[model samples]
Target chain A: MLLLSACGAREVVVQGNFPKPLMDPLPLTLGVIYTDEFAQHEIFDEAAGRAESDWLVKTGDAQVEFWNTLLNGMFQEVVQIKDSQTLEAYKNTVDAVIIPAVADLQYTIPLHTNIKIYEIWMKYRFKMVSLEDVHGNENGDLSIKPDQYFADWTLTAYGKTPTAFLQSDEEAVNLAAVVALRDAGANFATSFSRVPDIAAWMAEGLQPPPAEATDIQRLEND
Target chain B: MIRVIQGKLIAGLVLAMSILQGCVNATVDEMTFLEPTEGIGDASVVIIGRRHAPDYETEFDFIECIGDHIRRGDNSISVLHELDFINMMYPWFEPRTAPLRTDDIEKLLSQERVANRFEELKLEYMIWIDGSTIETNSSGSMTCGVGPGGAGCFGFGTWGNAADYEATIWDFTDEIEVGRISANTSGQSYMPAVVVPIPIIAPVQGTACDSLGDQLLKYLSAKM
Candidate 1:
């Protein structure tokens, strides 16, 4: 009975924890914005080199919220803005803005007589530019060009029985996509020092030391 | 009444001995598959057994026979043993059990020295064979020892052997799977010794090699 019971059952879950920043967090506030096409679900075709409308994923806001929370926990400060247009409003408040897009999202489910395999792949592209650069107010004609970064992730799972196979396949595909996006978000939080111009600007913008309180009598004597 | 009971006891003893007797024969089961590889002709391929087998060292001759069959089937395909390839490309490795990432392959290809070396060799594919043939079941045993006169064995024995192997093909240029062929051969054998001796052996490894080699040949052949 035990052997027969075990033949039809298996479970696997893969999730990566965000790593600590290698260097101290940059003393810079940042804004994040998603593209207008972000919410629209797209099927990326490798042969065609284009994306078409497919299954809709209504969790864009939730995903943005997750990144906002994760970045805030990792960095000095991060604010999730509505879109690119809204990024201009935070020019003076935040030091830089990041535009992220889901460039590719797809999965393949291979069927077998007694087993099933599901593989999910995702690619995310991020563009980062300082607020001053976006407003065309460069510091002494030295413009900071936007930096681009890409993260591609693939995840797979296997199932044995028909019912369990379908359920696990769906779960694996969805979880893989979500985890890939979140991982890219976490990576973005700790990658400021990689860009030379941003690193230099951050170094110059370090916060001032706090003033210590002094006793009233000592102050008067001084 | 005493005579009848003695007759019945002898009959029961003979039945038990007959039930426990061993004989010499073999049985086998096999499975094979082939997929089309459209343009993989004349590619350089090396076959090797994994270093870390469960109990026994992998029989290299079995794989050599497979390589021979593949060469005979396709004259254009270049085949080499793993040791020769390892000697040539001493520093680098083609990992087994996991797919190599394209980015990593690209990095190796991007280096000027490695790229030049790779251009010289133009090695593009690999076949990793892993698994073992083992004795699954055995019953009854024959014992023999040398005395002043000679050796002798007193009993009978039988055993079942199983050979399971999986061969994975990799395309280095694309960093993807060309195909996978798995072959399993299982059989049983027996040995009996009374005055003279008789032994039967199951060639599980040979059967696996032949079956897997044929599958690889058909799989790599271009689609019509």
Candidate 2:
């Protein structure tokens, strides 16, 4: 019974120190909402065989920490709101609102291979709602409806143990999770502005005045 | 009779020690693209491991071993810890975001923040190590059993391991790949048991690390 019970369960609480990204912040205020489910996310996978163990991985704290550090570095101002309702309350105070959720997570173990490697894959769903209008407004305030989102995208990240030195399954999973989180942070930081909608939004802000308006100003000066 | 038994015990001890120290063969090769001109006076260098490969990753310990070897001899160059450099550079040096080519690095340095950090670190070279040690083959097995009379393990097993790694040196000052070094090591490990199992492990990865490290030391210090 003891021998059989040896493969009962493996639990891991992922933790790591996430560094602030070293990039110029975008000139926009962002309101972020971390849902309760996102802040306390965990995944459980049942054991498939007598030799395989069940895994319960808790990645809540690390997720919040990583995204917080990344967003703080990527934007000029970040406002952490309680939920969507709070975001609605602060709609006029911020340029955009972003909500992030874990879409899915998958893992692989060495039981299927000769190499002692552990890998983790994560998919994240992000909803970005632009409160400001793409075109200039009379009062320079472009508040859109709270429920409308300009961009909803998914990002995937992957991580694996670099070496076979780690023996414990829990430790391996934690390390893999941390690596995946770091990869996600890197991907988001480098590619956030490149997302088509975000790019168009930013470009709109930089657009030159209309040619007719320029000619009218020139005529007035003459 | 007593002397004979003592002699036999001494022989057994000698045989066990010999078996414990496994056999490993390692080779290192270097290719210099452009010779280094300036000395490393006050500048530092960072050794990073490539982890972007889908199948394998360069071990962190191996990179650290190479760093330790480089710093061992006289007039050692300044070496930065891989994690420290990665953390300081943040997303830029991550596995997904790291520059894969010399021109990519130049473009990264064009950024004001990256440029500032590079200048602050006084980084002159960046050595990116890529590869891994893997067990190539395994054969034979042993069985262990316990009985009322006694417990015994009887089996013979053997396995083969190989370590292959390559290091590419990028001269940040010149914004070019200056040199490359590669190491390949392989060995066979054995386990033969009668009543008690004895394992003889071949240190292939360690041998590869040492060989690669020595060559990097010689190559980098030669510039100074």
Candidate 3:
């Protein structure tokens, strides 16, 4: 009877809040870049081996894809640059570059208990380097240095049976990854619209292009 | 002996109470607003999640339920779900350590891209939702193991769940906080036979959503 009383399921509470965008999001052309090696950001456990099965190795790809899907329409433009060469090609086209890496991903099922605790996290680095920084000025003089910005976000999820914990270890791990990546993508998408420094940079780059003669004439006619 | 009978009776009563507690429903602890709510007749308002919290299952369902209830009160007010809102304004603002201040709202309006959309949508208000439903406490346990045929769980247990939510209303036209509504609810569930877990608690999330939605409409009513 005493054991029965103690065996009650532990409360499963997954709590967090996503903030509303303070102001309208800035209209800036953004690029997402992934290095050759880091592109496959698979998670590993303490045993120095892959945390999940072979199927889960591509989880990192999903995160990057999610970021693009979210940011594509929200900003003026979002470009996906998979390698350094492509990043170089788009130097003049994009206003900023974002590199997201999976910082941590692990799922552990304790030896003594059926409960499984899974965790997933992502880290993002941002750099705003103008075309002038790389190609030099009209006079072929490299006058301005690249302005750099870095932001790191991590999300952890816990699953203990009867509520938070799911039925299988795989399921729990997948759930954690999905939740963590969702937040990471959300944070990355809105970073420039909220962060003071980044927002300023975005605003500076967001000056409206000179109106065309036809556009002006149409407006005047209206 | 009579004494023995009394001891059993007391134990039975305690068990009955514990089990019955799970069936109680949830309710709104308190909801408050500052300035009088303006009539939002025919304006489109959206309910969105806070950009910083961890999301769980049924998150959208929770928000949708509230939206449905709010719409039920005033059919004219178009309530946009979180997904629709996000689609309209993707790449939301960054996660804030704290809620946005007046200055933040101004900055947002300064962006032509965002401002134009708000104008196009005729968005009048935004309700920011933050909170979750979690298991708070539990007693008893169940054991499960895999056999040759399949895996199964055995044993009996009971647990408690608490649903807490806070909704803050932001008036876009005025660019100020109209009011704040919060719901803190508690409930419980029982597993008479380890396999089936039955929920019995007061003020469940459904109740909270409905109550909040109605209260919000009432507060926003021109009649109020």
Prediction RMSDs, each to the true structure: 20.0, 8.5, 12.9
Interface RMSD of every predicted model, in angstroms = 15.1, 1.0, 7.0
Report chain B TM per candidate: 0.68, 0.85, 0.71
lDDT of 2 at B98: 91
- Report the C-alpha lDDT of model 2 over B101-189, residue by residue, as the tens digit: 99898789777898999999999889999999888999998999999998989999999999999999999988889989999999999
Question: Which prediction has the highest DockQ against the true structure?
Answer: 2
lDDT of 3 by residue, B27-67 (tens): 66444555445667677888875545434433566788888
The candidate with the higher DockQ, 2 or 3, is: 2
Residue-level error in angstroms, candidate 3, position A143: 23
DockQ list for all candidates: 0.01, 0.62, 0.15
Residue A202 in model 3: lDDT: 49
Model 2 chain A — which ten-residue stretch has the worst lDDT?
A213-222
Ranking by TM-score: 2, 3, 1
Give candidate 1 misplaced runs (Cα > 4 Å).
A1-222, B1-41, B52-59, B94-104, B145-151, B222-224
Q: Mark the 10 consecutive residues where model 3 chain B has the least summed lDDT.
A: B90-99
What is the per-residue lDDT of model 3 for residues A1-222, given as tens digits with 9 covering 90 to 100? 976543332222222222233243346777655444345556433233333222333464555456556666456677766434554567778775555444445444433234323454445544443332233234322222222223223333232222242355455555555555555555554444576655555456643223222211110111
Clashes of each: 0, 0, 30
lDDT per model vs. reference = 0.53, 0.81, 0.56
